[model samples]
Structure formats: structure tokens, C-alpha cells
Target: MSDKKIEAEVRQFTVSADDDGIRLDRWFKRNLPDASFNLVSRWARTGQLRVNGKRATPGDRVETGQIVRVPPAETPPPTAAAKPKVERPTLTEDEIAFVNEIVIHRDPAAIVVNKPPGLATQGGTKTHTHLDGLLDGLADDAGNRPKLVHRLDKDTSGVLLLARSARAASFFSKSFSGRTARKVYWALVIGVPDIKDGYIDLPIAKQPGTGGEKMHVDEEEGLAARTRYRIVERAGNSTAWVELQPLTGRTHQLRVHMAAIGHPIVGDGKYGGQDAFLTGSISRKLHLHARRLRIDHPDGGQIDVTAELPDHFAESMAYLGFDPADGDLPLDEIKFSETAEGKRRAAEAAAKSRRKERKGERRSRGNGSEGGRSNSGGGRSKR
Candidate 1:
């Protein structure tokens, strides 16, 4: 309260270690509680706000020892309404217990959960009940709720990771974007793939009419998406249990790729349609599950964890005479760049580079020839 002054005066603050990887707006909330977000936006827009002498935005992360330049604060006009703070929804006893039961692994930096099928990760229109809304139950003693770093489809069950703090969230987000995190998923496709172990190199784009909720293979206009799958066991041509590792993260990449190859995941009506179902007691739940995750931790070592299958998936495996013990197959000990698709991409890029080099060489030779002719003719090209 004492820092608030009517006279125009600029202020600068050094980012502390605890505020290392948080957003610029978040820093304002923590240090200068009186500074409203509207004021911050105005400062950022006019180039009055800066981070280490460069113009900065609210979303930019601040590191330790960085200088954050702030504009002068002024008393708000009488008409300006105070910004309202959003609070977390209260959870009932059962809801609190349900979230606590899903936690599989907990550390200082991360929390892993065994999310069940039919439970969405975040809420959306017409989706009032989701894991994100119940996160208040998972708050630590200090009331810091973990943040979701990645997402799983509403019907996909398995290991989902959460960051305990903003620093960990930043670190994990980078790991995922950089492709250093490894995720293993298990699914039962209707039919077996002929090539037991291979890559699905397909480009995907949002489908035309589904309002961006659906994805399809679009060779010309799609983003590059790849998945590596290996058939673990076959059930007499009825269904096959496969391990899928996505090399690129795309919306519905696994489901789309599997259906594209004539084998759709069991119970996936969105992509597989009516043929995705099976006769008998098999449950009509999506057969895909995120089996395992391995990623570097923010503090020191790595976090490797595997989730247990839900009741339906487990029963289905037993009915097909497949042992659950064989589900956790060792991840391929080969680098992604060593795959067949990787080699093809590398070759294509190299060829393009060679073409450019050849064109440059030809241009250089033409210029040299012209220069020689001009010199011999006792003339020179003007600069």
C-alpha cells in the first residue's frame, strides 16, 4: 500500500529464484498485487514494459536475475471496476476421495494418475464434470494445485502426468515440444497388421465438417504425423493387441492412423464406425490406453511409470487368452532418426540442399564468365 503513489514513477525488480519460469503477468500478481492485468497489458502494448532491456509480453517467462521494467502506477478512475478473482470449485467428500485414489506416483515435482476411461481431462462446453474441475482435491498442504502438462482423450485410460509447480510445468512442456519425452500406449485393433513392426508415416489435418474435432489423412495440406506400432499378440485373426508409440503429437493421430490401415481400434466409433465393435461380452469402451511414460524430471533423475489397466480392458484381455504380463514390452532400443521414415526424410532434405548448392554454383560460374569477358573487352560492370 505504501508503494502506491499518485506521482509518475517507474520501478524495476529483479526476478527471484522462486519466480524463475513463471509468466510476466504472474510475476505481477505475486510481487505487485495492486497492479491489475489491464494495466500490464497497456504497458506491454506501448513498449513501456521490458525484460532485460527488451520489450516483453505478459506471456514471456522471466528467469532469475532478469530485470523487469515496470511503468508508473496511478490511482484507478472512479468508474473502473475491480478485477474479480476466480476461485476453484469446492469438491464433495466422494469427489475428493475419487481424485486421491487415482494418484499413482507423487514426487516433489510431478504427480502421475491412472485416469479411467470416460473421464475427460478438462472441461468444455456441455462438459461440467472433468478431472480439471476436481483438481482442488489434489492440492498440496500449501494449496498449490498441480497443472496438466499433457492431455488424454476422454475415452482413453492410462498414465497422465501433472506438474507440481510452474517451474516443472515449463520444464515438462519443453520436454514434450522437443520430443524428449517417451509415451507408450496399448490398444486392441480389430484386425492384425501384416507388417508386425513398422511406422505409420501419414500427414493429418482437421477434417472438413467436424468442426475441428475430427482429423483425417490429408497428404498435401496436413501436418506430418508418425506412429510406430508393433503387434504384441494376435487372437486368431479376430483382434490384435498392439503397442503404439507416437513420434508426433497430433489430434486423434493413433485412432486415425490405425483406421487408415484397415484396422480400427476396438470400440472406437468415432473413427472405426460400426465395424469397430465386437460380439460377445467385450465392453463398448475405447480400447486405447496410455500404458507408460518416461520423461526427465525437473529436479534430477527421470520419472518412469506404468499404469494398471481398467477393469474392462483387463477382462477383455483375459477373454482373448492374452496374458497381461506381456503387455509391458521393452521400448525399442533404436533412435527415432534411425527408422525407415527418418532415413527417407533425411534423404529428401539432403537432395533439396544439393539442388540449391548446384544452382548457386551455376550462378557463380555465370557471373565469373561475364566478369572475364568484360575484363578482356576493357570494360567493367558499374557497382
Candidate 2:
């Protein structure tokens, strides 16, 4: 390892207010502009960042009035010892076959693949095969390594975007951040929404008083979030096919919002009903897919890409008595409530607990544990 050191100062600010309560590493990237998000994540894992002088976890919230202490980075010294070479694994024939079958649309700026359910978009620790790993062999253009610009859940199949070059990747990233890219998702949801078509306008805030692993609707403290949905087909009395467009990007925003309104998407384990994983039901694979994407092409034209429905989605469509080739469906306007009661309850409970703890500490200090006290019943013993 190479030796390097970095010193940082403590700051008084809240991560929740700044990021609408995003993950700690994401918040660090926004605040410490010079620090790489990956490096910040490393620091978090190694206990280099602290909250109120105690080591902090990456998921811990930096609330208002709290002081955050960012410690200096400690880098190990390099040695002259020879390093062992590690071999890269070759792709299996089965993996190659899967990649060869998924290409639906391709262009100079972007490539859209019909991702099958259970295939990961990118690799991580313990991931042996992923879309990126298979790309070098599948690309039609020689010497080009396709890069994924956005991600789909591992279990949710459909359209996945890949940028052919760094320039294209940057352009698409900006478009997504600016809310100019149009992403349409297809899902089979439990029960039809009360309204035919509408926008969900709820503001999304991270769950307060806990680590920032969950999000909830909070009108006062949450960031503005919007999603529009329209019913595509009614699959009997219990389920309906719908199209979704998110106006704001929040992690798992669509799933959470849908569940909040009593219409969770089928097969969604995190937010769906109890029987979500059972076979022979609509709740087996989350039934959600990134079906279409429309964006201003990096090469100066509009590009619209689509992915064909996977086998499961097709089976559900046929079961619902809807033709898979239908071009248009009625659009509905669904709106979400600006405020959610759950978030308010959490915030209030947090405030109350903080006040109680402060009071208890004050009493403890007054009761004398300061320097030294005579525990043995002596007449005013001094240390």
C-alpha cells in the first residue's frame, strides 16, 4: 500500500436537510466536493469518520445541531515485495448465450438491452457475472466497452441503458440529474388505484430517528417528489398493469409511494404484501420493469428505446386478456399527498427522546460524579 494523509475539519450541519436524507457517502460527496464518494465510503468502513467524537457508520444520520468530525486518512506504506498476479475469470458459455440474446436496440450513443430477471446490471463483491462483465464480448463495435448509465433492480427485468463512451455517459448522467430524461416503467400492481390516472406529488424524506436506510413521505422536511401512473390493463379484481413515470429521482421512490397508497407493486419483497415470494402469483418477481426510455441523444437527436416484455410479464399480460402488441393505453393522473403521517410521528418521537436524554444528563451532572466523593460515611472526606 502507498502512504498518504488527509486532514479535514468538523462542520456543524445536518445531512438530512441537505440531501433529503440520502446515504452517508452520497452526502459526503455533496459536502466535501473534493473527496471521492468511493473514498468516503472507504473512510466510513474503516472508522475514519465520527459523529460527536464517536465512530460513525455509513448509515448514521447527521442531524441538525450535530457536529461531524472527519478524521485524517491513514494510508499504509508501500513495500518492495513482489505482488502475486491474480487471474481474471473467463465468461461461461451459458453467460455468453444470455448476453447474446438480450440486445433489443443499439445506437452510436446508447444501447438498450432486455435485461432478464435475476441478472445484475453491474458487478460487486461476490458477483461472478453481470451485464458489464458480458459487454466486451457482446459489443458490435470493436474496442468499445459499453458502460451502464443507470441500473435496474436485479429481479426487475426490462430496458437497461448503456453508454458507449465516457462523453455519452456524462451527457446521460446530466440529463437524468436535470430531470430531462423520460423513464417509463411497467408494473403489475395489486388492486387498481382509486383514480384512473394521476400524479403522486408526495415529498420523500429519509426515515428520521433511525439510520438512513429507509425513506418516508414528509411534507415539511422531505424533498419534492412526483410520479405519474396510468392503468394499462386490469388483471382480474386483484391486480392491474400500469405504466409509471417518475418526475424526481429518489431511491426506491416509486415502490415506497405505491405501497403508501395501498397499491404496492406485485412481487416486491420490500414493499409488497406478505405472499410476495410465493409461486404462481403475480407477486413472484416484483412484476416491475424499465420498459422505455426517451432522451435527447448525445449525438444531437431524440432517441427512444424500448425493451420487449420478459416471459413472466408476457404471461401476466396474456392472463389479463390484453394484447401484448397494443400501442396505446389510457393515461391516468394520480397525485400523492404532500405530507405523510408516519414521518411526522417519527420526527416527533426523536425530538421528545432527545429532550428527555438532555434532561437526564443534566440531573446526573448535578448529583455529583465530578472529582472525588466520600462513599464511606465519613464527615466530608476530600480526595
Candidate 3:
């Protein structure tokens, strides 16, 4: 390697067609492999790095011909600035086989899998193996890892969607964010709901003391959450199979809503307490399952799919004499009244989405597939 010192000056570069919509940090990793995340973050915070004369965040997407200015990087001592490179973990043979067995449908644009219960979506603290790690099974021909369009809880097993390419990912994510996608989840609650077919309109907030991924009904200082549930069948008064459709995608929304209605999903001890348990040889695993997903396909059509129940859930249903055949009922769309705040939010979102749509149309006309974009606006949001 040459021992020349880096010049203490600013440098600007234009984004190429292939690199459109990629994160600034990712662009740096590809263009300047030696730049560390810490260095990029520090440079962004100090305004030493910018895009088209504007301050650039590491998460910001650089468009074609956008001028990205980078300050001269200081070369610290090799031993002091040695940053470890993160290598993506590969799936084991068993994991790959498991993925193959669970995959219900796949195409060039998307892969729909019947994710089993007890598997986390993304990796986190005290966790290593996850659905994200095992997604190599659905990688594209170019070895691009599929993108997660939505999330399901670790304890709830059901249909999970993944996009095969960046363009498809953008389209699906925008569809989900824009409320064009519909979801149907099935669960066995402890008690039969008195109001068999009604909506559970309640606000949900992060419980202050749960110390983990737990939520509570807090109409005062919480986000608006709503779910419509219909009782499909009941086994005595102890358990009932209910079909649910969530209007807003909040963390732990379904679990919290059912519990709020005094018929917590069976085996959801995190919120249901003692009532979550049942006697006899019935399984204690969470009974929630994502039964169906309906979304607009990237290829200009609708993709509606259903997932079969997991083994434990199937066995439990058999033990309770709850037939699965009768659970298939056409899903109904639910509507809500627009409050003052809701109207304001709706108007703002509509305007922003329209601008993005126009920008996408212009880009498509100029660059075709290379500039294809969705309402997600070239990149995913922070949260």
C-alpha cells in the first residue's frame, strides 16, 4: 500500500445511475471502503459532508447527478482506527430446508412464507438467528437480499412478505404505508367476544414498566389504534376463534386490543395473566397467526394469499374440535370517521404522496427502470 497522506481538501462527486436511491453511508462504503460509520456520522453532524449544497444525513438517498461533497478524511494510526467489517451470516442447511418447507408462494417480485411461531423477524439483543438472517433463501439472481415489507410478532406465526428487488421493495413498502394493503389475522382468545363483529377502537402506548416489547391501552397518551374482529367459532365459553383486521399497524396492537376487551388470546401471558392458560393437553404457545395478506403487486395487479396454521395451533384446534374449514369468510373493509387531527394528517399525507408520485413519474420518464420509485420515496423511513 502507498504511504501517501490524504490531501486536506474537499472533494465532490456525482451520483451515478446505478447508485440512485442508495443511502449516503452505503454510497461511501462502496466508493470509499476505508470510511467508517463513525467517521461518516461525525462528518454529517459537523456539516463536513453534504449533497447539492445541503446538509446530508447518513440515511439520506442520493439521486442521480446529485453533487455529494466530502471533506478530506484524516488517516489515523492503523491500529487505533481498525474497524471490524460486518459479514452477513449465511443460513445453515437445516435453516434453508425449513425456509423451503414454509414458503407458500414465490415469484420474481415477491416471496410469501408461512413463518412459524417462536421466530423473531429481525435480530436484536440476546438474539442471533432470525428471519432476516434466513432470507438468503429468497435472494434474487444477482444475490440481492429480499426486503421485509412488514413485520409479525415473534410469537405470532403466519404469512410474511418479502420483496425480491429494490424496485419491488419500494412499491410494497409504499403500499403498506399508504394503507393499500389489507391483512387478516386469526387467534384463539380466552373468552368469546360479546360483540362478535365490531371494531376495537382504542389507543395504545408502550407500557412504561414492561421492560420489553409490551403495550397497553392508553387512550390518553397513545397512538390511535383500531381493529375489527369477528368470532368464527367458540368452544364452550373458554375459547373462541376470532378473525381480526387491524386498521392501523401499531406494535402489539392486536394482542393489547383483545386483552382490553377481556378475551385475551390464549397463551399470551405477557398481557393475559392467568387467564391466558388452559387446562388439559392443549398447547401453551401463542395462538395468534397471520392468516391472510392482500396487497397491490408491483407488476400491476393484486396479490392475495392465505397461510395455513402452524403445527401447535392446528393441533390445539383439533383438540378443541374447532374445524378450520369454517374459518374462511370473505374479509370486509372497515372505515372510520376523520377527526380534526386525522383530517389534517390525511391532507398532509395526500399532498406529500402526490409530490412523490410526480417526482417518480418524472424520474421514470427520464431513466425508466433505473429511476423507478414508490411513495416510500426512494428509501425506507427511520421507524
Candidate 4:
């Protein structure tokens, strides 16, 4: 490593409301553009970086009015090698037309595409022709290709958002990771759930021996996962069209959760086994569709866009005697505090409070202390 001298004075910044809820590394990229991510991470790892006088990590969220302390900025030598630029791949005419055909909405900062089923978002082993490979078709005159902010499953059809620039990508990425962006999905399940509308607070983990290609519910060593599902219309007791909202983002979360409840999503044979397929004229394609996306725009206001269902999903719905119009339900903003897990937490807290009260009473009786002053200055906190 080359010896580099750092400046003596430390830099301090107060978090702004606009930058609130963003990651610490992103904060540096926005305000201190000169500081590279490597430098910020190094500062954090070595305990040179702090937030509100506490050591912080790059993933830490910053709140408004919080003080962020940074070590002295490092200046690289003038003779340092310049970083190589990523070459943008040239796209064929057909590739550009294909990507453009899927574009349902486009703005200065974002591009919303109705990605069809069977198309992988990004390429992997044995996967070449994917959405990411063709993203060069969406590049602008400056050769800046739109960046994918979120991804959908290969067999899932829906609205996929893309950022037009690096700055927009950072902003949109923060919006998604912070869980401020809302996604509404429509799916057809094998059977109707007993509860018309309820939250599925089941933890999920990757299944063993699947090479991380599959997920399953693992209560012991799984990540907290929650999904809110509501039955839209039932075709007798056989099948039901449902609206799904994932409270937490996990790989194949909706598919895994539905299958765990004995009502697997239509055509998801990987998780649902043989029962995932339906009889009669119903199509065997995956019925899950990302119907709508509502997110805060970096340019201000909100970008609320809906995607039209694919031909297979639409055809399946028609064959199932369900109206396509019924799938266009309003997407409401939901809070975790209103979920079943939230209620359970509240009950536990109340029980703990009662237990503490009883313990205090017993102690007071044993000590014979009378006329104890009660503290009644409790104040509610606002999120």
C-alpha cells in the first residue's frame, strides 16, 4: 500500500430531512462526492466514522438532525492510475425494439417496464439472454444505460422499475431498501384462504441442498418475513384470485409463503409440487403479476404506475370466470405496526407491564412503604 497523508481536521455534518433514511455511504456520495465508497467504508470499519457520537456502519440509516462525524478526507496522489470506464455494449435494432415494446412508463429518472414471464431479470449460469443483457437498448445518447433498481422472478410478470442515471439509481435503491416504496401484486392460488385478509408472519430461510436456489419456512434460523394477502374473488372453493403485499422483501417470498399455507400460487411447481397446476382450460403458467408500483420520486411527488397483465395471466383469469377489472384494486399504504406480529408484540408488552406492576406491589408490601408517589408523565412517541 502506498503511504498517504490525511488532513488533520475532522468533518461533521447534520443530516437533512431530504437525506434522512438513506444509508451512510449514500450520504457521503451525495454530500461529499469527493469521498469514495471505499474510503467511507474504511472510516467506518476503523471506528473513525460515527453517527450521533456512536460508531456507525455503512448500512446504518441516518435520521434528520443527527450528527454524522467523519475522519479527515484522504487525497490520492496525482500520479495514481485512473479508474477504467465500463464499456457500454452495442445493441441490435431488434433488441432496442424489444426493450422499448415493454416500456409502459418512462420519465426523466425512471423507466417502468411490464416484464413478461419467462424472461430472467439478470443472467446467471447458463442464462445469457436476460433483461440485464438487453438493458443497453435502453441507453441514452450519452451511452448511460438504465440501471435495474429491483428485480422480479423469471416466471413472474410485472412492473419492474429502472433508474435512468446513477444518481437516480442511488435514490431509487434507497427508496426500496428503506421500504418506502410500495409494490402491489396479483396472484391466483390453489384454494381460498380461511381468513379473507390477514398477515402471514412466517420466517423464511434458504432450503438446504438446493444450492440457495429454493427457500422454505425456517422458524429456528430464518429471517423475519411477512406478507399480507386478501382474497379478491373465489371461484367456488377450488381456486381464488388474491391480492398480495409483501411487508418484507425476500427471495420467492410470496411463492414460499403461499405454499406454506397449503394454497400455493398457480403454476409454481417448484414450491407447490404437483398441485400447483390447475385442471380444465386454466393455463399452467405462473399467475403472479406485479400489478402496480408506487414510490416517492427523486424529482418530488410520487410515481404511481400500473402494468397491464400478460396474455397468459389474462387468459387464465378469463378461463377461471374472474373479471380482469377485479384485479385492479387500490394499493393502500400499510404499516408493520398494524399487522398480526404488531398486535402480538403489543400484547407481550402489556403483559410485561402487568408483571412489573405486580412485582412492584409485592416489593412495596414486603417493605411496608405506603403512599408511594406515582409517576404519570408518560408521553407517546411519534414515528
At residue 1, candidate 1 shows an lDDT of 9
Cα lDDT of model 2 by residue, 1-383, tens digit: 01122535433232222233455565575555455666667767887777767777777755422445665553335765634644346777887687777888778877778898888776766776678789865655476667766677677788877787767866776666555677788887878898878878888777877566567888898766778888777856677778888766676788878887888887786776673333463336667888887777998987777778888777766766767566244323222222222244467789999999999999888676542344543535543
Best-fitting candidate, scored by lDDT: 1
Best by TM-score: 1
- TM-score on alpha carbons, each prediction: 0.76, 0.63, 0.71, 0.70
Off by over 4 Å in 1: 1-79, 336-363, 379-383
RMSD of each candidate? 8.1, 11.4, 14.9, 9.9
Error of 4 at 133 (Å): 1.3
Over the stretch 1-383, how does candidate 1's per-residue lDDT look in tens digits?
01334456787666643344568998798667677899888899999999989999999987644678888777668899966766667899999999999999999999999999999987777888999888888899999888777789999999999988877876776666555678899999998899999899998878999887898999998766788999999999889999999877777889999999999999999999999999998889999999999999989889999999999999999998889798788875656476433554688799999999999999999999999998877754443
lDDT of 4 at 328: 71
Give me the runs in candidate 4 sitting further than 4 Å from their true place. 1-89, 336-383
Clashes of each: 0, 12, 0, 0
Q: Which 10 residues in a row give candidate 1 its minimum summed lDDT?
A: 1-10
lDDT of 4 at 376: 25
TM-score of 2: 0.63
Checking candidate 1 for backbone clashes, the offending pairs are none
What is the C-alpha lDDT profile of model 4 across 1-383, one tens digit per residue?
00123558886666643454568887787667567788888988899999989999999977644678888766668899866655546778998999999999999999999999999987777987899889888888897778776789999998999999767876776666556677889999998999998889898877999987898999997766789898999999999999998766777999999999999999999999999999988888899999989989999999999899999888888888899787777667566466433454678799999999999999888666443322222222221
